[model samples]
Target: MAKPIVSMINVEKWYGANHVIKNCNLNIMEGEFLTLLGPSGCGKTTTLRMISGFELPTSGVIRVEGESVEKKEPYERDVNTVFQNYALFPNMNVFDNVAYGLKVKKVPKDEIAERVNKMLKLVQLDGFGKRRINQMSGGQKQRVAIARALINRPKVLLLDEPLGALDLKLRKQMQIELKRLQRKLGITFVYVTHDQEEALTMSDRIAVINEGVIDQIDVPQKIYNHPATRFVAGFIGESNILDAVVVGRNDTGIQVGTEVGNALGVSDDETIETGDAVSIAVRPEDTLFSQERQPGFSIRGVVKDHVFVGNLVKMMVTLNDGTEFKINRFSEDEMIEPGQVIYLYWEKEKGKVLKTRNLVNTDSHRDIKGGDEDEEEGYAAEA
Candidate 1:
């Protein structure tokens, strides 16, 4: 692999008694959309601030392009940040708002005008330059802010939830626009967002941060399909994270015994013994239900409830031994009612075994029986 554009080694930060970031090490390649993703207060924003020079690490080395830059000021670094709230000048028009940075550096008037106009066109705000900052819509204002940041042509752009303040429809629109813009410019983007759907939609790779440490870092598909920790299985998407013990192993796959019965299992590339403790992650989308019991792989469960969510139907089922799993059915597919006994099935390979969740030591599992202990911790719902 080529040298990373940015690298953090053994990064640690503390605010008095509170330890914010703990021994975080990450390498970000050039021109890739890397997201610092987690719930609120998980040190995602803190990490972003450290990278942008708003806050210094208590102990760590932050290198940009192989040069340690902890001593550099924000302006000295070859980067720019776009805040959640559009920090445009209320007194200035769109053109002037996008030209502020160039004016600060005393760039030539003709070049500033040319660059500003070209950026406005690039962001689809060519004729809106004459509009006042207060007069533009929320999305328009955001685009103007982006145009201003890109006018400087920084090596990397740091966006702190820039689409957060928009309405849902506009937020979705901006999400697509932001990803398109990144590819068009071919610049590295370090995005920070608590919205899992937003991160999944825009990030090339996601760094799932928790309690000041990174739990997993991989492409969006791998992060969702093969989560490294139980929290990630629950946090990235809706999952059935069941506590199980390894029962047997073979080339077909390993078998794990749950409270209910022994079921076909899958795991990460780690070695596990017959008596080892593990958790199996089965996504809602991967779950299958049938009226006829599957010979040996199916588990018997009672349907507790079902809800229609647009194009998908979410059904909650509890096993005979009290373990619960949520299965998703398409809106056009067969329907099952509450109190109905059904057999839930899934492919063995779809069940991923996550490593132990002892680092954070908090249950991130969503129980089908209805007690959610992680509610107050700001755990987000996956798309």
Candidate 2:
């Protein structure tokens, strides 16, 4: 196995009484794009800062290239940071800004020019050397920032939401550019961002952090398909979370009962017990809708709303038990309308049952298989 280029062991941080990062541990491979993904104040940024030497851990160690870097200053560490803001010197032109690191290192004048020009060309800004920082567009300024960071040829590059300042289209364009650059340079990139799509689109692996703790770490596909926790399932994408009770278990799958009046067969994770309460998560796109009744694990509901997106249709369905479920359909044949009776079903493997700390009550009338109007009314009253 290739040894990890960076490792965090039992890392913790604090802001006075608040414990920001709690015993976090991660290993980042060399020449990989690893994104720290989470919502704001989730310690993703704090963890990134610790790795960059901008913030030291209150406890534990940060190792870079197999060496402890606790005592190293930010400048002394073999890494460079590209901030959300371009942070370029207003008076300095593109060439001077990119050559600043080499100049500070006192490289020969000829070497500085050679490196600066090479980096500008790498970033596709070869002839823009004389352009002032203030004269550049947002994308141009970002490119200059990237060139300045790359000119150092550090072992790792830390990007703190580097594309956050650009507009949506420009951000998308830069995402492709950044991934290409990373591939060409073969340097470890530790990127931080809250955009799930950005992380999914660019990262080799993503560490999903929440409330200062690492929730899960895996490749984008694994993280999306097999989330380790409920928080991860809810945070990474849109999912329909339903309260379910484990009814039975078998070698291949477990049986779950939900209030939507369906007994679903779900893949087992061995964490579920016969009587344990769990939350069932199904991705919206995984659901199949039809006007006719379906045979498999199906629930009948009225389409409460229909939204036409470019390529997909979004729907909100209210079941007979008054439970609302969201579904997405991709077919464009006929538009589904509100008040239309529809059946929603998915394959057995599409639903995931997550063990919850609290066992939800599964004995309500809504949890039963009957479609009694009075029972539905009573269930609504209790809700």
Candidate 3:
């Protein structure tokens, strides 16, 4: 079994009187890419800082290689952080910046030059070592930052939204590059980001945080398909949530009466009983819509509108009580139009039932936002 390279046991953080991270626990395994994903002010960044020794926890233990890190300073820990701004010195060239760590340790000049060149090559900045920081592009500077951080040969690398400043196209390109580099190096990475797609694209596991609490932690597919909480379902992706109450149950699943007056059959949970309120989440792509009534589908709604968005079409259907349900389809072969009534259906198992009390009291059709500012820790001198 792979040992956990980093562990946070019952971690808690407080900024003065404000409680930030609340009883957060996690284990990042060796050589795996784990992403701490959440919206602004959700404590994702703070959690990463705690691991990197940038911020100290108010309570609980943080361990690296099975040893506690609570009493250690940032530079003493066997970890390095790549910040969003790259944090390179304009006075130094790429080679100097990459060689700074080795020079600080008083390594021989010949060895420093050899390691710097290899590190630069690893990040694809081999021949550009002589170029000053100000002369490099955003993507190149990001590569330099990563190379510099890794040159120290730390056991773990902490990236705090390192691609955030790049343009959309460049950001997408760097995502692939960063993932490739991690796989090649076999180093444990504890990444922090608010972008859901970025997390899904690069993570071996994702810990979804919200309001100082972890809502769920799992791989991308599991987090998307079987979200453990209402906040997770709404936050991770676009979900059509039906606020419902359990009406009946059989051997297969439980039947729930939604606020829109439709009965939805969802996979059963032993703890859920009739009269219990639950939220049903169906992804837009999983929702099926047809002009004619389909078997096992009793829900009726009027077509609101649909917009062609690249490879797929996005549709909006309004229920009788004015709840907007969304659907996504590959093509408009059925040809839906506004004011036309349609029947909605989905596979029973696809309708994920979230049986939890931590519900976000919001409309099903809107984008979910995690409230507050992500703790912006002051940047100190790097080790």
**Tens-digit lDDT string for candidate 2 (107-194):** 9999998889999999999899999988999999999999999898999999999999999999999999999999999999999999
Candidate number that wins on lDDT, 1 or 2: 1
Judge candidate 2 at residue 9 and give its lDDT: 78
Residue by residue across 196-300, what tens digits does model 3's lDDT show?
999999998888887888777778997888787777898888998877767877787767777566555564346677866677889999898777777655789
Give the alpha carbon lDDT tens digit for every residue of 91-157 in model 1.
9999999999999999999999999999999999989888998899999999999999999999889
Q: What is the lDDT of candidate 2?
A: 0.81
Q: Please report how far candidate 3 places residue 301 from its true position, in Å.
A: 1.0
| Per-prediction tally of clashes | 0, 0, 2
Q: Score residue 145 of candidate 3 by CA lDDT.
A: 93
Q: What are the lDDT figures for the candidates, one per model?
A: 0.82, 0.81, 0.83
Residue pairs with clashing backbones, model 2 = none
Q: Compute the lDDT of residue 278 as modeled in candidate 2.
A: 69
Consecutive 10-residue window with the lowest summed lDDT within model 3: 374-383
Taking all chains together, the TM-score of candidate 1 against the true structure is 0.90
Say which prediction, candidate 2 or candidate 3, comes out ahead on lDDT.
3
